[model samples]
Target: MAGTTGGAAATAPGKKGETPAATRSGALKRLPLALLVFFAALLYSQIQPPPSKVPGAPGGPPVTAPRTRLRDGRHLAYLESGVPKEEARYKIIFVHGFDCCRYDVLNVSQGLLQELGIYLLSFDRPGYAESDAHPARTEKSIALDIAELADNLQLGPKFHLIGFSMGGEIMWSCLKYIPHRLAGVAILAPVGNYWWSGFPADVVEEAWYVQFPQDQRAVWVAHHLPWLTHWWNTQNLFHSSSVKGKNPIILSKEDTALSQKFLDRTYKEQVRQLGEHDSLHRDMMVGFGKWGWSPLEMENPFAGAGDEVKVHLWHGVEDLFVPVQLSRYISKKLPWVIYHELPTAGHLFPAADGMPDVIVRSLLLGDE
Candidate 1:
């Protein structure tokens, strides 16, 4: 009886097993599947991200505030602060940087603006806020838009411009394209372009290396493969902006704390209102795109204008967003610009308490 069970279990394995020849054939049968899987994975690895699709009308709540019409019939929305335009002794147009909107201006005191008679104008750039998106936006077109806005507002022939971060970067566009329309300009912690041919190779390399790896790739895509920009930034699977609103590591510890004074939730909410395509993506395209001219190549727009004209650049040595060397090079090239290097500050220094007032005073009153 035991033999019956043992015979089945201990008999030659061939009782229930395939022959060596059969096994060989089975392995051969699996070869195509193995190869198919291997090739499929290989192709997947080489595949690029799909191109970005057109973003529909923005998703945020409708903006109820006033909007100025541009030359091309696009409505440009803005936030007004401080004194009335007629009563304003100092007319300031504040420009916001990446991942920001019209409301991103420094939280300056109404009392301060009142006492100084300041009219602060902060506007959403094309594709931001309630402003109409411009598919053909270019560096020169943006500068002209600001100039035309001034004419439409009767802010006089020229107005003071104060821009920070990417906003600071756009001041260069005005300098290049519409300097005659500017009374004075101030740029704080502006971003720099790595592809600027004028920079010494070694210096540019050093500055470029300081950026976070993600930012380096973002910049590379923005400058080199611009067509992939929308997908690179929107796919969210890989690429995103370095200056992530509140978590921007590019700023210093102190600057991060200082920035807390302003309510950023609204800023971020409004920033995304128009989608990244027209705002951030367009910013990268125009900012890092082939500008054909660098800050080094620009002429001193205020050179012969005496004390009546001024160009101020404020940079902090502690800034990781824009390394000190880049600003130093700009200062060296444009000797007429009053360059202020803050030792302990970072990129967001302009947002510090009382700091906005100080910057305004310097521009309007000088060293009085």
Candidate 2:
């Protein structure tokens, strides 16, 4: 091969009437192109996007469907599944996670909801899905939205609550403010509050170190500089939360597939156009902010319920998004929370097939 290449090179210079100087000139000309390619690749590999400016739409287009009006005049778009309100033997409210809306309910079977007489309602939080944005939304205020939503619909004196991921983190607010109105509560694979002072140093260290560096920065920014939450998530020059990425805060292949439905292109563009202040950013700001109390400081919320009011906490053993160690610490501190630590599951465990039935049944029908 070497002899053949040398013969071709010799023939090309002689037969083509090309001078040695010309050949050298051609080689020199190609050198800069190669360098340009190398440098372009180097820069491409190093460059990254910036965090958003205050965090915009959390995705899913504004709801075009008729929306229910809360007393405060803000509107919420919701989806209802299973039995009608009156025929419902079990009325449950599902709080969706970050970057999702009313459409992203659990993978529960219609047969199960019908057979069990379960009426599940999922709604968009203010500032998402055409739900009127609440400029002054706080942790307590958002929780009140849930209570008022129930009251407006007249969902009787009490209803069951199921919160997934970010939904689960804020579920604490409901436990704090509206425990009397809850028949039961199920928190699934909740996003842990790393800034919560209740966690031990070792537990916090273990969980914080396991997170992807970008997510660590995201948490750090959200906790320390709440004002920069949007920019920290949307800027084009730095790493941000996986919330808007291909693999959100999930760890399993099953969860990966579950996330695609939320990360659709058309869905993203639709919501991005609204340019509303995002409820999810508020979730991050309040989620890591000083809540004045911690779940570790919580008494059994169901302690005084006249009827059976079970509080179930389901977490995945393999969950790295929020780490099982933190959940373990929480369960230990609040022993009344019935902890279900599933083996080999990840952050999106709540979306697994047949899991919804399991969670609801455990919450209402007892742990049969």
Candidate 3:
């Protein structure tokens, strides 16, 4: 009797209809909303809804686990994420440029390679990541590194090589040093050709965008959006409907504002020079000295890579990094190559769409 108000009586808020049972019922009734708020926060954390990854910002492809070191002393950091079926005609080895890593191409490339059952191998070049850097490395030395990797991986005698930017020069050295091993080659925005063809203003500007990471904020505002640089160039590369109306042309006013900010940030982040210690231009200069510069030379792995071996060519029509005219002119000279000009694309190809299929068809569906 000292405290009849002890325990349940003390804890309970007996205010009219708000009995302990009634309060419990009210909490239960609101549980779903509470759960929803919790789940909504979780969902928001998982997906970056609209216009974050691509043009429309819709959720894009799933991220796959890239393979790291498999064999001991292999030392190369590689991504062998795509499934390689026995029937997969050949594995595609992607070589990234100076100071660049596998991430530069991996995000956009996985879809196309996976769809066609083609295996992909992208690794941080020596010195960039796990691999050791050779000072002022020549294309020959880089090619040796690639050859060593291929041999270690047992990719077989008929692998295809796809090189981007400075990587193309490394590939040329591979071809020069070990041509018989490769079945085909695809070069994207290579350096040597641009020297002969004359770089487009937009492409040079874009390269500057790539070279100067800090200038992205000002350049992006000047260009209006990050992807706009590609969009404006794509207009010349493809017909309007070819890209399935995924043109950046139709950006809404709100998106335009957001996109400009997005672009400004992305350009800054993307322009990192990977292997600056081993300048890509120096490799070219030496290779140029050895091979000698000519508008047409059999010394170019690209010049001879066309016939017998399958080749797929893509360059932005308005590509300021490399000339579309060079891409066209080169493809024309080579009878065995298939070329696609992205009316709205800049230097980079839209890997999500049908780009890989085109490469596969070019490789498999020949006169056979």
Which candidate number would show the highest TM-score if scored against the true structure? Answer: 1
Q: Per-residue lDDT for 1-368 in model 1, tens only?
A: 89888766654444365565666677889999999999988655543333222223344457666888776778788888899999988889998887777888866688889998989998888877667778788878888888888888889977899998888888989998999988888899898887776788888888888777888887888889887777677655774666643445665787778766554454566666666677778788888888777788888887778889888899998887778778888898878889999999988798788888888888887742
Q: What range of 10 consecutive residues in model 3 has the weakest lDDT sum?
A: 48-57
Winner of 1 and 3 under lDDT: 1
**Model 3 regions more than 4 Å off:** 1-75, 84-88, 106-115, 193-275, 279-295, 299-308, 332-337, 350-357, 364-368
Candidate 1 clash figure, as a count:
0
TM-scores of the models, in the order given: 0.81, 0.79, 0.51
- Best-fitting candidate, scored by lDDT: 1
Candidate 3 RMSD to the correct structure: 18.1
For candidate 3, what is the lDDT? Answer: 0.51
Query: Model 3 over residues 1-368: C-alpha lDDT tens digits?
Result: 65764655745675654678887888889999999999988755533212212111134222232333323332455666466635565587888754456655534345655566677788866545334334445546667777777887878876778887567556556666777777777766554433333345564454544422322332332234322322322244434221122245433333334334324444233222222222322333343333433323434444544456655565666444334565566566655455666675554452435554554455544421
lDDT per residue for candidate 2 within 281-333, as digits (tens), equals 66677777766777788888777664588888989887767778888889999
Please tell me which model should have the higher lDDT, number 1 or number 2: 1
TM-score of 3: 0.51
Q: Global lDDT for candidate 2?
A: 0.76
